[model samples]
Target: MARPDSQLLPLGDFKPSDEWQTHVNAIFYGIKGPEIHHHFQTYVSRDYRLAHALADTFLEEVRKQRLADDTITIQEWGVGNGNLAARFLSRLKSVDAAVYSHIHYTLCDYSEEILNGVRVNPNLQEHEGRYFLKQVNAETQDDFEPHSVHKIISNEIWDDLATSVLLQNNGMLYEEFLQPLLQRNIPNVPWESFVEQFAGKDLDALKKNPPFLEQIVWERSFQRIDISDWPYGTFILKHLDRLADEIPIPINTGAFQTLERAKQLLAENNLGYTSFDYGMLSDHELNLPGRPYYKLYGGQYTSMVNFPLIAEVGKAIGFADVQLEHQHDFVGRNLSENVLSALELVQVHPRISRMEPWDADLLMLQTLQALNASYRSPYKGQMDYPPMPGTPKKQRKQITELARNLSATGVPDTVAYITESEVAESTGRLKKLGYGERDLKNAFDRSTQPIAFGHMTLR
Candidate 1:
């Protein structure tokens, strides 16, 4: 098969195929519904330290505050699959069963499907009497009661929140671009005509909107791909311009105004919240040189990191304290080294072969640099592998032999790979983005294994 084009594809015809939609829906709702769970799980498991540390810290904070008691209520704004919530509950149960015995959980998400999935977890079945799952949009007030929640947690949810402006831009441009295509009803429209009519117009419109335009130009540019019948390419180019036009400008009065409103809501309720995701220079972290999270997926430069604008609004709204806690501590020390090492030595080696139904599937993902440096595959390889017949014994024997060899040499496969020119290219990209040798070393050290984060709670 032809290599899957990595370039920016047109959103005009970008309706998710049924299978893709299922994947997206499963993720959006936080349901560990097959494909979606596997997609995120590989990275999370490999980065186990990062996941556990964040969850541990958040739960520890709640524990320290003595909020595990029945009277204290915790609500997760974008509680996906209740993973973090489950972890928090487990920790509380371990510390003092009574404290967790009757604790109330309000799990909220935008998708009803996710909310429903939360309601059905077997682990949660015993505690079903104490939990509530609701569909909520963070921008609106109807879904939650004011000043009622003691702690709010969200993980990896804010970045995807559909802002009115984003939707408006998408809807408007989609309508405009599609009108021509739909009118023609041919397989495609002329590339140049599509660009002139939609792409140029959208950019012009954005330029006119000084605030949003400044945000796009100054903040960051997203990944762009060039397609060459690519009438669809031209159409998508127009769509992207529209999307870029929708990005809210930073350092502007209008931007501040929206932030001010968000702050008002947080203050009005006096709620304590924590958010976990990738971003640089948060509203809480002023004057610090912002770091990019992932160079791929639009996080190329310092500005590409998705700033916690909502959390900023919350602080502005008058919360006592607002901060962006780094996941690096977890990512580096705990995930890359400790937790993953433990799993490798214990669970994976001894139990995997003997077990009939293996507990977990494992897969590897290259870092952004590694991916970019390597030959791009048309198919993004599965991050998780399913159990195959008669393979356990062979796999176990191979693993044992590999381990014995590694023990003698004391060198990892990743270390060997890093010596290559391709790895050098990846390391160079990382260095250019402010990552030091230590960072690269940590990345390389952890590359061979899979990592998992325990949970993420956003408030």
Candidate 2:
């Protein structure tokens, strides 16, 4: 639904300053800095499944280590308001008390203000002495010594980092740099010029003036960029090698750097790291493309990760094993049988209303969690109003309602492969991971509510 405002006038008059990361950094790390919770709350939902997967990854690592430090340490990059941390800690507690007690969860974010804001979260608060709030950069673990942490996890952090927006026309490549349309939000041409243009018009008006926008005007800046010169030209050839079509994909340079940093930050052979971002896992997936969707929202920018590239970079970083899979596959692999069974039941009554059609599966999973926990179906009287020990009121209402219309004969056949979008790959990647097609489908149906999402992990 969103596209750049760049008008295609002849490339004749275009200026040169190809720097998408700068404006992106300026907006996210500067202007609205560390105000990440605000961005996610408006655009995405709380992903409980993802948090569970992350916790499971770390917990498994801790168990394998057998408490080397007697305390496991993990530093999550870009913890924002720490809702994910709260959910992770809560789930970790429920699954294993010993693991939960030993976790030294470090909430890292570059914004100190946001770091301070997360300290008060009741979910994170319950796990007292098990948390640390630190202001740090995801791309650089300069503060920590090598092999200092057990796991490095970031959800959607890579997309926020700087990226190069390149374009391919004919055999040549061009970079898309940004220059703020100073006139769009500025009263005059530029800030300094604005005051001169307005002169002495009410000095007090400046204080209550309409908020300024850090709106970026995308300009094709091809100056001094000769792709035919050695590494620069080699970069073009590198992308050319990967091109299914001559689409200019974003070179997610930040993801490469981040992985490099993560490799260094990880314990020698401990849980490497896991980063979940909406991305493409294979160049074949990029076979049809207008450069996978990137969006600009509220002055913040996000683009689908190039997972295959990330994996390749991980390999280049000397990581022996790099795995890339769909988000559902990653989260589904760790899902309990109860949650999986509940996933199947939701679709049994396929007509259930969900706030987001895509999230129908997850919403259903959340709604039926009581059933998963208590071993009761919606039709059972126990899962009702003024609910018994296992069934809470929320589960009673939602589950009871489903039970009324439920029919054993109507359960959906979820195993058949379903490509959620025109561009989604049709291959059964999860099947290779030892998952049943139907259950994989259910997991995908529940979680792929957001746009195309992929998971990349290296250990």
Q: Which candidate is the best by TM-score?
A: 2
Largest lDDT belongs to which candidate? 2
- Looking at model 2, residue 353 earns an lDDT score of 46
User: Model 2 shows how many backbone clashes?
Assistant: 2
User: Compared with the true structure, what per-residue lDDT tens digits does model 1 show for residues 1-459?
Assistant: 533332222323332122222222333243222223433432222222233444456456656765555465666666555655654565556655666675677777666655666666555565655677777665344544445666565565443442111112433422111111222212134534543433333432222321211111111222222333332234333334423333331211122232332343332322356555444334323223332222211211111223444344444445546554344334444334322222232232233455444222221111332324542322122122334445477565543443333222221221111222333455655454444555434443433111122222223
Q: Per-residue lDDT of 1-459 in model 2, one digit per residue for the tens? A: 423333222212333232444334433544343454443341112335567677787777677867645667887887766767877888888999877887888888876556666777666788789988887777655888888887887877777776665556666666655444433343433455444322332323432445343334444444324556532345445755767545546667677778888888888756778887776566665555554546665556676576766676677777889977776565556754223323333443434443344335334434333222222211112211122235655665664565444332221112111123210232243233233446444543444222456767787
- Candidate 2: list runs displaced more than 4 Å: 1-18, 29-38, 42-45, 182-190, 193-209, 214-236, 336-451
Off by over 4 Å in 1: 1-35, 42-70, 163-271, 282-305, 308-312, 330-459
TM-score of each prediction: 0.46, 0.66
